[model samples]
Target: MSQIPPPRRRRALGCGIAATAVALVGIVPTAIVFVLASAMDPNYGWLLFITLPIAVFFGSVALVLGVIGIAFALTDRGGYAWPIVGIALGAAQLIPAAALLTG
Candidate 1:
């Protein structure tokens, strides 16, 4: 006799909440910093132009992740992948900014 497969587990998207919060909190600071940097150094400001989009994208992803996570959790389904995506996009935003500072 063939055995039946087990049901898939539903994981939570913890990163989603954190990412949304981070984005909400980070937006102003980032904008301010970007403006200041631009005022001080146009080249650095340009980096902000590039990095800001990533941050916004990630922030939006995070919001979506949070919503999807909640919805899936309520429906008893798995939908935690969004958090990972949020984190990835968030990091994408940070990478260039960090690199600018480091390099």
Candidate 2:
């Protein structure tokens, strides 16, 4: 017989997926902006101010969601593969944004 998953497991999984999606949404646009900025003339450098803030905002959101997802996943007996993935993706989003801001 197949075993059914618990409610908490489902919630954790949902949160994990949401976090991963958020991170991807944050990263993709920033990547595109970065590439475009690099390819274009130096005069448009001012655009970084606009794109960077948006990317940072999304990155922060992803990080928060990923942390919450990880916390929820850790409380259950089920595997936390998705939450781990979410955390990784969230970090991926944050690192580039931080680097852009700092550098």
Candidate 3:
């Protein structure tokens, strides 16, 4: 018989999933906006100022959530797959945001 995961494990998994979704929600739109902005005239560059800050906010939230999810999973002996995925996605979002912010 398969045993059900504990509540903590389930919560951790949910957190991981949420983190990944948040990261994607931030990254994808910002990427599209950046691409469009780049293709357009320099006058549209102001769009980056708006989009980049939003992306950074979401990325930061995702990173924190992913870290929290990972910690919960580790402590509860929950499976690590989702949390790792969350961390990867969160990192992916952050990298571009960092580059945009610094560049």
Candidate 4:
């Protein structure tokens, strides 16, 4: 019998996965900072300096990646699931950045 062909590879899939992972990774420090900021005094505000940059950087990159992934998805270059998740999560990741500035 003839062998079956391998599955087709999707474009932008890596971007979607990377965006989701970046967003998730950014959340840890953001959560930590949020919890600490809530529990402690402004004296601990110094911690924001450490995590804020990381959060912003990750969040921004994830948002960009998510957008690119969605573009590819729309063009039928890739599947839609991961890109949607990436967009949602990446937007959520930005909340900590906003909080960092406001708090």
- Which portions of model 1 miss their true places by more than 4 Å? 1-8, 14-43, 77-103
True-vs-predicted CA distance for residue 53, candidate 3, Å: 0.8
Specify the poorest-scoring 10-residue window by lDDT in model 2.
Answer: 5-14
53 in model 2: Cα distance from truth in Å? Answer: 1.2
Question: Could you tell me which 10 consecutive residues in candidate 1 have the lowest summed lDDT?
Answer: 83-92
lDDT measured at residue 14 in model 2 versus the true structure, 0 to 100: 80
On TM-score, the stronger of 1 and 4 is 4
What is the TM-score of candidate 1? 0.39
The residue-level lDDT of candidate 3 at 28 comes to 82
Off by over 4 Å in 4: 1-6, 36-45, 96-103
Ten contiguous residues with the weakest lDDT in model 4: 40-49
Task: Flag clash pairs in model 1.
Answer: none
Best prediction by TM-score: 3
Best by lDDT: 4
Expressed as tens digits, the lDDT of each residue in 7-77 for candidate 4 is 87676687789888988887788688778778976566688778777877888888899999889877865
TM-score of each: 0.39, 0.70, 0.73, 0.70
* Model 2 deviation from the true structure expressed as Cα RMSD, one decimal place: 3.6
Clashing pairs in 4: none
lDDT against true structure, model 2: 0.72
